[model samples]
Each structure stands twice: as C-alpha cells, then as structure tokens.
Target: MTYSRSQDSPDRRAEFPQTDLRGSIDGLLNAFYQGTSKEAARYDLTTHEFNLLSACLKRKEECTATELARVLPVDASRISRIVTILVDRGLLKRRRLPSDRRVVMLSLSEEGVELTTRILRRINRNSARLMEGIDEDEIHIFTSVVSRIVTNHDAIQNSE
Candidate 1:
C-alpha cells in the first residue's frame, strides 16, 4: 500500500492577515525589548537598569525614587528592582534626605557614570548602523509620524 500526504496539511507560512492587531503590537514590543535587553546585557546591565541610568542622566539634579518612577515609563516596583541592583553593583548611590527620611535620592556613582557614558557610545554606534540607509528627512518624518500616533492614542484615552 502507498501512503499519500493530505491536501489539507497545515500551511507553513505566517498567517499575518488572520492575526490580531494587538498580537502584532505585542510581538513587535517584545522583540524590541529583547533586542535592547541583549544590548544592555553586553555592558553588564538590564534594560530597566539602563533606563534608570538614562533618566538620571537626563535630569538636571539628583532624582528621588518616586520622581524616577514618575519620569520613567516603567512601574515603581521595576524602578525599585533596578535601583537595588545598581546599588548592589556599586554603580548607584542612594541616600535618605535629612529633611525627609522617607525620600531616597539616587545618583550615579563614579563607576556608574563611566559605565553609562561607555554604553551610550556603544548605543550611538549601533543606532548609526541601523540608520545607515535612512536619510535625515526620512528620519524626521518617521519621528513626526510616531509622535502623532502617540498623541492620537493619548487623545483617544482622554476622550473615553
């Protein structure tokens, strides 16, 4: 007897048309996060840790844990975890303010500052590689479109 393959065998290709928009968004977000995490890991840091460092770098002065939680897009617990790890690594110094014992201010230690600067240079190099084929005008337009998408989402949420 001869055996034959079924004509209704499952398709091997991606069913993009059948996939939900939310699923696509989730996939892209996960891939982006994973890539960034790998990049951070190369420099002995996690994405969250790098984000905290970046937030501190952007701030005009020392920032408190609450302030960091507010400024960064992540939740408070995640901020706390990253802060704890940075402190353990001796890359971040946390001090309780004399005026307010409840508030813990965070600042980069000398090592943390050095590490952040080095990581930033590496990130810039990687970004340059990614933007190699893209022109300045196209980059600006892309950024504008992204900004509009964010604004549109914000408006939708506010209108609800």
Candidate 2:
C-alpha cells in the first residue's frame, strides 16, 4: 500500500497513474491526520478544534466566524459550533463588535494562547523531524507539485 517514486517508470505518464497517485496522496494525508488527531487529543482538542485555535493564534486579531470559514476549509456553521465549544471551555473569547452587534468576533483567551504556544512548539519540532532527511530542493519541488494538484482540484470542483 506504500508508494515510492522509485517504482515509477521512465515515462512521465507512468510516473503517476491516476488511481495510484490518488491512493498515495490519500494514504499520506490519512496517516498525517491520524498523527495530528492523536497529538491534538493530548491537548483535549479535536483536529478541527486545534486547527481553529491555531488559526486564531496566527491571526492575532479578533475575527468573525465568516472570516474563519473563508480561510479554513470548514463551513460557517461548523465554525460556529466549534467556537461555541471553545468559548464554553474558556479557551476562546467571543465578543460582539460595538459597531455591529450582529457580528461576533473570536479570539483566544490567555489560557488558550499558552496552550496553543506549547502545541505549536511541539508541532514545529515534529515537522522538523519529518523533514530531517529531505533537502530544500526536494521540499520546494514537492510544494510546487502539491500546489498544482490543489489548483487542479479547485478547477475540477468549480466545474462541477
């Protein structure tokens, strides 16, 4: 079930037969997310919850649920639910904009900030370990290919 580029033939078409390429990418993402889920659980957070927290940490600005939905893959309703859970857990602060009471802005609480920082350090260390053997050129090429794949996927989705 594992994939290796060494298994590919000289023909570029054979470099990634459709099903094999899809399977390889799926397998890689599933494995990566499994690890992430385990790590997030250690902090009493689901992968999605951790992602929301990380997004808040990165933005460092109070953002609306709609803004989060735009940046994240999750829909607005899901973001709202997660935000509610986070707010209840005291990991997030929710406030209405004075100018617009209808707009609820979200930011991390102090405790949330501390926990997120620790988790980020661990994630950064893990990522560094994951990239240990890979050179910068290989990383660049991989990133480029992934970007193209994502673009192609978006095009396909839009066509549908």
TM-score on alpha carbons, each prediction: 0.74, 0.82
Name model 1 segments beyond 4 Å from true: 1-35, 158-160
**Candidate 2 — worst ten consecutive residues by lDDT sum?**
7-16
What C-alpha lDDT does candidate 1 achieve relative to the native structure?
Answer: 0.77
Candidate topping lDDT = 2
lDDT of 2 at 109: 99
Clashing pairs in 1: none
Question: Which runs of model 2 end up more than 4 angstroms from their true locations?
Answer: 1-16, 156-160
lDDT of each: 0.77, 0.86
Expressed as tens digits, the lDDT of each residue in 110-147 for candidate 2 is: 99998888888877777777678999999999899999
